[model samples]
Target chain A: MESTADSRVPVLNGRRARNKHDKHQRIFEAASALFTGQGYSSVTTQMVAERADVGTGTLFRYASSKAELLLMVMNEQMRLTTRLGVAESTDAASPNDAIMALLQPQIHLSLAFPENTAVYQREILFGTEQGRYRTEALARISELEDAVGNILARFAQTHRIRKDIDLNGAARTVFSTLHMELIRVSLGRQDPQTLTATLASHIDVLLLGILDPE
Target chain B: MESTADSRVPVLNGRRARNKHDKHQRIFEAASALFTGQGYSSVTTQMVAERADVGTGTLFRYASSKAELLLMVMNEQMRLTTRLGVAESTDAASPNDAIMALLQPQIHLSLAFPENTAVYQREILFGTEQGRYRTEALARISELEDAVGNILARFAQTHRIRKDIDLNGAARTVFSTLHMELIRVSLGRQDPQTLTATLASHIDVLLLGILDPE
Candidate 1:
């Protein structure tokens, strides 16, 4: 076994890697379909495996359990949201605009898949399996938070915000405010359009606190 | 009922009211002990009924389910925190001091019952039974936020903050920040003392946004 790689099994290794990637993609698609169709709690791992056309063992190798699988889907969605949000924020003309651009994609994602969004929020905060995936999920969110912080730091450079402002803390505050707004929307306390508009106003108030006075 | 009143059953009615009050107290104590001892999910309605010496139907009459019971305990704890916080804040020398004083009791409560606090946070945010108790919890929390807003408004009267500052929004923002801080503590990401200190700093930043410039 130790001599296999030394004997030049690169082709075999490459094929195995491709197969693993394909299986992972199939499992993700299957899990997403099942979860969206029947909700997160009702869908079983066996069902996902059957739908993905993979062995149960193969599915387990991809994700430790159903909750981990759910987190995997969330991780992918968050990655996409962060990528799109950063791209959207690139053309922002001011700090508030940049903040809004960064958050708009996430709001759209939440609105587009309200059920999944609810599950994501619940799982992140309180799922029993949270300990297993908390680091991974937090890493993804930290990336988004850092993006917001970067935008604020850029504003500080331009003298829009106070030169001595704590960009990281301010960004966390902004992200937390948006988070509360999302919870309100998910709980049906507010509509999505209102959440978006209200978020803009909240950011304006946040900016008023952080930005240099006119 | 009117016929009974006309028949003059005043002594019987008084005894019945006292019995009902005692039963409510006993139920609250039993539910609190069992939830804390075995955790929320593991403790069943039957178990609570047995501990409280009440019928299952009676427990249902008190709280519709285990989740609701958890919320009931949380509701009581929050009421205590609010009352204590308000009392402490009455001696606050400034708006910032008042805000900190208001949040300190809550932080102490969270630290005292870390497990219960986690369950409370989760249930309030995402429990299925939340719909039943959301109005009640929101009403209680609104009173707290309103208290914070009123303090801010009082400060405005003294020119401590800008007169036109959105006190309600500012209060909400402040509350959200403390909420995030609490979540961090419940997740074991931050120590209680650090949370208290950091929250003070966050409130200072919040003040910067609303306070009149020097």
Candidate 2:
């Protein structure tokens, strides 16, 4: 009789876990669909919950805030882009080329959904240190920077990158430069192609240095 | 008869003008006090109006939104710092030094009011182009970028800077790098001094560059 009861409890627990996972997936898909190439300011969490067929309160369990909801969507993009970017970086022609390789896909990701990218970046840049999603977002950013650091370190070993510069510090600044340029895209000041070209030139300037060789 | 009617209208008009000016000043002062080093999300326009001793409805006439109110305060700060920064840049020893001189005060201005700066930047960075104040804010930013371009042009004329690079493009990229790093300060990852030092070093890296003397 105890064995029968225990077996019934595990079946109930399994169903609960599956239900929770399905709900999470629905919320995530809803956010991703709502956020894709849309003005983030216009997309309400209530709408996301409605789209997901979940109650608004239940949506809060998945993402505490709209910023977090965007994070939930963006963080996965971050992970995939970082993996793809790192892979591209490995076989590049030079240190500068490698760094560009690592960052190009990121640039594409950011530019693809300019609205969502701006909000996602705004949250990371200005959002306070709170909530689980922000922590995860920061972790993804950290992982990307570490990938940059590792790339720089590899180049430094081959004397392709300057050894005197701190690898991690340089990584942060390099990415900071890229991140800012990416944010500049949504300003409507420049066309995407012009902005991308200017950013490429800026990256080239960074590699070549602005000072004339003495 | 016409002179007497004109006299009455002028008296009323003068009082209206003075009332509007006084209320604007009050709202500005209230916002400055409320926003200084304070979490922007916590401060309400209602509180600002109350502190200014004006009705909340009246406050809307002065600033269309809280972001605009922050812009009103920060735009003044931006103008003052740019003037002082430009003066300092003229006496700097090198191109990099000149750029740093130009940006150092802007950095301090940003770091001094981390919360306000973040919001101000967020508005300018991501805010929709719909309001009068944001338009003014963008003009101020354009003026600042032009200043950077002017400085870069000066350095280029002396043959100290590379002539091949687009000064305006480089200036834009340079300031973008600084702005992003300034945003980084509010993340609670590093102290102000550490951040400043690292930023200075990053500027150095951008100047001296990463590739060995080619």
Candidate 3:
């Protein structure tokens, strides 16, 4: 009887895990639709719960507040964008091209939802310390930086990257430069194409120095 | 009689102008003290008005909200810092040295008041668009960028900066990079000396590129 009871535990645990995942997906979908439909400020948690078919308490359990929910959605979107961008850049001919390919998707995503992007930027830059989603956002950012670092590592193998270059530091600077460009784009100061060109120029300056090589 | 009336008008206008200047200074000093003593969020406009010895209405007239008041204090502080930094950098031996000299003072200022620096960074990057102080902040940033551009211009006259370089673009990039360094400092991720050194390295990469000259 003890052996039979122990064997049944896995089935129950698997069902519970699946239910939790389904509920999480439903909440994310509902929140995304509601947030994108009405502005983030106008939407309420109760409405999200109602649409998600979960108890308001369950929604709170998943996300402490509306801001956290927004961050969760953003994190998911960014992960998808990174996936697509990395896949697209696999065939990039050079390090600069790979860096651009990685960053271009993010710019396009920001352009697609400028309002959300602005809030995301503020949250990442200013809200990270106090927000519950800080860990998640930081993790995503580090992952993005790692992706850029990987490209540079690959480039370093074939080309002469500076001997004194700090790989992590260099990757971070590239990531930061891309972030600055996105901020410019979010501000309507640069369109996607203009940002791409400007970013390419900045990367050139980073790799080639502004002094004449001759 | 016409000459006497004209003389009286000038005297009245002079008194009014002097009063206005005095009140503005008092408010700035009061807000700065209060904010530095007890973080920004805890301090109120009412408290600021009382401390400054101005009416609450007058406080609002001078600064639309707490955010704007914080920005006003920051703008004043930054101007003073910039003046001192520029003065200190006057005899810098090279273009890079001058840029670092100009930036080091800012790092010192931020370290002196990390709390206020955090608020100022948020205000400048995320708060500018929505705040009443937007124009003032943008003008100040543009002025600083122009200062950097002027340095590059003077350097270019004697040195061989790449012909393809855009002086304004280069200046903006340098300004943006400094902004990034400060944000890291504000986050407690970097110390003043480390930030200064990293900024110098970043500037070297910007000016000389990461590739070998030989």
Candidate 4:
């Protein structure tokens, strides 16, 4: 009797879950299309609702506002690419391998979704209102900084870098420099292969400057 | 007498010039105030015209659109700073000295009118419908890039950098790195001095990596 009840409950919940997911997917697709065509400034919640074929209240249920919607879209994109993991140097024989791995995904992301990347770029450079969205964006960036810092820390430890070096500051510098280089590449001013080679060379210089003598 | 006629003509023309100048100043002040308070999207031309105490037609004659008005304010600010000649580093005895001089004014400006800076950031990251304004922004950036490139070229020559090194790419990398760094500083995640020092160190690495071997 207990097994029969459990089976019935899941079947009912499964249909409802599928429907909910389909609706959420529609909302995201609508937001992406509208934002790309009209930009963040011109698009309205009502427009998003209409495009998604949902009521305004339903759209609100999924995303509190347009800013939150934008963040969700970006977060989803990041998650998708992150799962693939970065393939830096197949040889794994070089000390610079870890730094190259850390930078590869970032460069690829900027190249992949230039529009969404621009959206995140604007939000970080100039924050939104004091709302849930702004808080989440700030939190997300902090998490990213921490992740990059952890990677750098591991690299330093494995390579026996100088104990006196300010690892946190070095991490931020590396992260910022890589991010800036990617933005320049996205600006359509430089070829990708040249940018990759130049950045990799610069990273080598920076690491050598601060590292302990091996 | 002929002297009387000449005096009358000078007085009349001077009065007319003053009147036009006054109107232009009023319009610009009004637009700047509105943009600072409500951002670029919330303000309209009618509101600016009303605040300036000018007719709608008069405002249109001065600026064709809201974006143009914002760009005009930025142009005026650049002119004021240019007249100050903040770019000079005549007594600098080293390449780093000259680079520091170039970067100081940028940090000061980023902190000064942060709102205006925010507007321009958005405009560049995402293209606006105002084609002329966007074009002007690109033109100004290219001019500034040229100045930075020339300075780097001179430094490379003096310091004996490698003959085969791409100075153009190196210049772009330097400028682009600093540009994003300034934006990061504005976002309140970084301390100004730390950013400056770290960037200086990064420049050292770049110089060391690219310099020709003795």
Give a tens-digit lDDT track for model 4, residues B1-214. Answer: 9877877655545877899889988998999789878767688898999999999999988876666788776766655553333356444656566666666665567667665665665565555455665667666666655665666777877776766666665666666556666666655556666767766765655566566655
True contact recovery of candidate 2:
0.65
Per-model TM-score of chain A alone? 0.80, 0.82, 0.79, 0.69
Candidate 1: which stretches are off by over 4 Å? A1-23, A37-50, A53-62, A127-134, A160-165, A211-214, B1-26, B37-50, B53-61, B128-135, B160-165, B211-214
Order candidates by TM-score, high to low: 2, 3, 1, 4
lDDT of 3 by residue, A74-193 (tens): 888888888888888899987789888987888788888766777787677766445666568778788878988888778667666566677677677776666676777776667766
What range of 10 consecutive residues in model 1 chain A has the weakest lDDT sum?
A: A125-134
Number of colliding residue pairs in each model? 1, 0, 2, 0
DockQ of 2: 0.51
Candidate 3 lDDT (Cα, whole model)? Answer: 0.77
Alpha-carbon shift of residue B157 in model 4 (angstroms): 2.5
Score candidate 4 by DockQ. Answer: 0.25
Per-residue lDDT over A163-207 for candidate 2, one digit per residue giving the tens place of the 0 to 100 score: 355668767766676667667776555577876667566556655
* TM-score versus the correct structure, for each prediction: 0.82, 0.86, 0.83, 0.72
Residue B103 of model 2: what lDDT?
A: 78
Per-residue C-alpha lDDT of model 4 across residues A97-120, encoded as one tens digit per residue: 655764566568778765556666
Q: Give, for candidate 2 chain B, the lowest lDDT window spanning 10 residues.
A: B205-214
Task: Give a tens-digit lDDT track for model 2, residues B133-198.
Answer: 888888877877887777666655654555355667766666676667666675555676776677
True contacts kept of 1: 0.52
**Predicted candidate 3 versus true structure: per-residue lDDT over B1-214, tens digit per residue:** 8877867645535888899889989999999899989988789889999999999999988887788888887777778888887897789998789888877777788888877787787777766346656567777777777877888788778666676677787677776667777787787767766677676767777767523344
